[model samples]
Target: MEKLRYERPVINKIKAGVPDKFGMSTRINTITEIEGIPVKDIIKGYGSPVFVLSESKIRDTYHEAYRAFSTRYPKIQFSWSYKTNYLDAVCKIYHSEGSWAEVVSGFEYDKAIANDVDGGKILFNGPDKSDADLIKAIENKSFIHIDHFDELYSIIRISGNLKLKAKVAIRVNMDTGIYPQWDRFGFNYENGEAWNALNRIMLSNNLELVGLHTHIGTYILSANAYGIAASKLSELAVRVHRKFNHHIKYIDMGGGFASKNTLKGAYLPGKDTCPSFDDYAESITSAIINSEIQPDHLPTLFLETGRAMIDDAAYILGTVLANKRLTSARRSTIVDIGINCHWSLMIIGH
Candidate 1:
């Protein structure tokens, strides 16, 4: 006779209260496999606490997002954001898919160059670009997104000294009906600071303002917020063309497209609550198309969507380390996966 399998005893106490709003019992499903491979087999071979990324999923997500925006806008380009996941394999996959590199620091810039991405295709963005970084970017003919006034002056001074014209864009921060505004990274749009910066750039002989960039916020739930942001940037572009007679090359709606990850205090799952790519594309494209800017002179749409593009393509596999009962007799299962496994959750406080 076979020995009886061991099992842990679990006790539950029903509390009297309002039932779940959805009128459905919450169920926990067990994940037994991933990408046709058994989870246990993978853990046996590679050990626990491993990360698995699906190449097909990445391509699918990218094409889905591309289709969403390209169908609405005439010209659209995607620059894979490096800060999201800088693993060489991940970067190469995006590069192979015809994505330009969008890096936020000197190290990431170098990584993009090392990955054989065309320097001109790279969009350099962030607040802490060093003089050396600017020089390298200028030499590579990269599109440097100026973050603050100091960076603008630094780029101007460097370009003047090198006798080279720096292809650049100014990062604009504006009110998009979102709370906890990210006004620290770029010039304010409503207060005329962004316009002032553009004026300064236009007057400079070495700096050529080819584009306008803005990243409203991260994991933004409202797609209308993006529409408002696009409208403001489009207005600025029209103003620039009117004053300088130079049409901007592109309008970079910087990343922060929300991924399908549930927030901490959410009423529904992210899959049900988060906006889809098509939703976001419609909001942003419609705003630009309806703006005062001429249709014939419409600029290229550049998106640096990071989280929404890659988050779902990757999964971290871990094992249950222990099970415990709290003082209130609540059950808790501790897993081997560390905080690093779900870094984005920490970022969004999920």
Candidate 2:
């Protein structure tokens, strides 16, 4: 018997008068290996459709963002957004790196408590909090950001029932020059709603307003928008201090930092276009520092960035299933994975 050999075929075609936009010469950059291990070996050991998360990458990204902020600002805290890749392993990694859990529901709060995170360190933000959830959070001393008037009254009732003062903040929704502004999370700043909430919280005996939060939008490309948001929140912080003689301990400009994932309709690759940690730090830090709030009274900066910190570290591995020809003689290949598994497909065009 003779051994068989493999060969690839090639063809040449004549050039036309016009060039195809999709026919630009592209270099195929294959991901042959990851973290000193061959991707093939990983697929062989773990099988196709396996998700491989790089522990080193996760730590590096965490350290990168932490360093970027810590070096610029004196007091900075990172709270891992539990909704973003809530796998216990992933959450533990962030916790080990000194991340406090930022949860929105009772289940995530339970998970954080189970994970040994200090209850005082949990920052609870969301619109849907049950009476029982409020009771638990109040008892645990979590920083709860209020979303609506109904929730505010509910917390007051719960505080009366439990006889415990709840540490809370009001989520402010403002137009920071970003389109499709995030107005659903908190009270509107421009319409006096945020001030109304502030006054109500200040007068309440059962609730302590400890911070101010604003989440402009997600995947925000404009760094200036963050500067604007930071200034606005600082302005409110000063106003709150002047009127109520109460100081906000923290100003949480909620996370929407762009990650390295290319968004749909992006002209340049995300790696090149996404703002760096330094850019964001400069934007927000400068605004807060220049605000009327005293330098010594500068509130702790809390960041809940999720996707920007972990997306690059997570990779979905799958094998090519088959290739088929289209009506236009174009070839398309299918993979073992689909949109459900790798949710990052939302940004990348198929």
Candidate 3:
């Protein structure tokens, strides 16, 4: 017969209403599994400190977010941002759900192509497009969001050289009553730079102005700010039609929707405080519908939100590595993984 393994005995103490800083817990609920799979089995199959992405969770979140916007707006399109979560599995999941790839760099642009996203569907954004990058975007007929005059000029030159009409948009930055405005990339709407860029694009024979884009801020907590942004973009679209008789095809409200994660030092938890998808959809859709833009030519709304869609669908599973006895006889456990979480980040062993 096999001998039984030796075990170390330990003392324990229990108290009623033992509480964490956030609140007291009547029961210490544990996450042993997700989507019907045992957590221990997953850990054993993969390894300690592994990233687990729930496919069903990802799909469910996508459907919820998509429905929130599509049900409210006449036309809506979602583009999954590579910067948000580029894990191939994650990207594929989003792509399968009718999302185009929104990339900000040459490498990421290529990555989208590699993932078999149609060239015309890819949105090329950011301020750092190289001549080569612009050439590829022009060749692919991708939506190139011009960030500044230099990039605009580059696109014009590249498209002229290629004899191709590059689908394009101008990224407009503005004071949307949000502090520390994102005025770094794109033209300033208040200063008439955005108009100047639009005029320049309309004059260019090789560039087709398809849309107006804006990324107000990241982890934005206010749904009202999105309404303000939509109003501003709609006004620009109406002006485009008035001046050049050109109705822009779309308005890209680059994503900044907050995930359910509390900011450091925040008093309230994120789950209770973050704006809902409905809140944002109501704000943005109402603004465009109420704007001066003609109802017959209302532009398609492009949303690049990804964080809120994925935060709840993925998690890091880890195990405790060692235990040390303190001078006061208290035990301390340690783990390999490092993280930043809402409450204190402590590792646990299975």
Evaluate all candidate structures by whole-model CA lDDT and list the values in order.
Answer: 0.89, 0.87, 0.87
Q: List residue ranges in candidate 3 displaced over 4 A.
A: 1-30, 325-332, 339-350
lDDT of 1 by residue, 216-332 (tens): 988999999999999999999999999999899999999888899766555567788899999999999999999989989999999999999988887777889999989987788
Clashing pairs in 1: none
lDDT digits (tens) for residues 66-166 of candidate 3: 89999999899999999987867678888999999999999999889999999999999999999998888888889999999998888888888889999
Error of 3 at 33 (Å): 1.2
Q: Residue by residue across 83-122, what tens digits does model 2's lDDT show? A: 9877787888899999999998989989999999999999
Flag regions of model 1 displaced more than 4 Å. 1-6, 9-28, 341-350
Candidate with maximal lDDT? 1
Sort every candidate by TM-score, greatest first: 1, 2, 3
Model 2 lDDT at residue 82: 96
